[model samples]
Target: MKRIVFFGDSLTAGYGLHKPEEQSFPALIQRELDAAGLDYRAVNAGVSGDTSASGLSRLSYWLSGPVDVFVLALGANDLIRGLAPSGTQRNLQAIIDQVKARFPLVKFLLLGMQLPLWVPGQRAAEFRQLYRDLAAENEMPLLPFLLDGVAGIKHLNMHDGVHPLAEGYQIIARRVWPVLQPLL
Candidate 1:
């Protein structure tokens, strides 16, 4: 079967959800795939609190099998921890490079993340630009902001206001579906 890997941090991992396998965006995508009778499996390679660097390091293991599509959703933790955008960009590029090297035919869908409005201007701008630059440079489709509709919506987020609740994931799944469907 063809495989689509959802590689990222907490948001992709369905953090704070009671039933991750059923509620996570990746799982939700899988459900859509199944409903459409698509012969594909959506693999959730999300690790809560993981950074771009860590994702890069663990990429090789996930590369063991054939990957038809790679949905990169990392870098949020890097931004949250105040890491330099340059470093995050570099790490993300390296990860992409490694994946391409392993699976030359693998398609990519980059999921971008944005900092809260409370963050400093330069940092937030830099963070946002990194994903845009990467997608442009790689000629890949990018979801401008992964949390576009869910962020800052009090009822949709967890108490920490960082992660989304189950309902929020439902919205995210809908947003991601159109982009992912064409890929499949």
Candidate 2:
């Protein structure tokens, strides 16, 4: 089967989920693919607390295998650590570049994150715009906010309020499915 690599941080990793192997977004998508009889596999390449730079550092491992689709969901950790948006953008672009070079036919989907408006700062605005810029420049699909319905929703998230619970992931899966289905 073809591969769809979901690369990102804890959100993509399904952090705090008791059964991440079966509850992560990637795993949920896998179930969808199977139910639809789609000839593809979902590969969850998410790592907890990974910044864009860190994710780039380990890109090769994921690229070692055949990749048909690449879903990027990084940058949250970078924002949390107050890293520069430019640096995060550069690292994310590098990841995209390397993946494209490795698999010319690989489709891409960029998952974006946005800080709440109450979190005041120009940096916050820049962080949100980076995804749009990257998506436009790369001519790829972009999910404006990965945690759209789940973010700030106490019940949908774990105590940490960052990672989503299984139910939250289900909503995420729903949001991503329409965008991802066309690519598949």
Highest TM-score model number:
2
RMSD versus native structure for model 2: 0.7
Off by over 4 Å in 1: 116-119
| Candidate 2 per-residue lDDT over residues 1-184, each given as its tens digit | 8999999999988889999999999999999999999999899999999999999999999999999999999999999999999999999999999999999999999999998878778998899899999999999999999999999999998998888999999999999999999999
TM-scores of all predicted structures: 0.97, 0.98
Instruction: For residues 64-122, write the lDDT of model 1, one tens digit per residue.
Output: 98899999999999988989999999999999999999899999999999886677788
Candidate 1's TM-score reads 0.97
Per-candidate Cα lDDT values, in order, are: 0.94, 0.95
Model 1 steric clash pairs: none
Top lDDT model: 2
Error of 1 at 86 (Å): 0.4
Report how far residue 100 has shifted in candidate 1, in Å.
Answer: 0.4
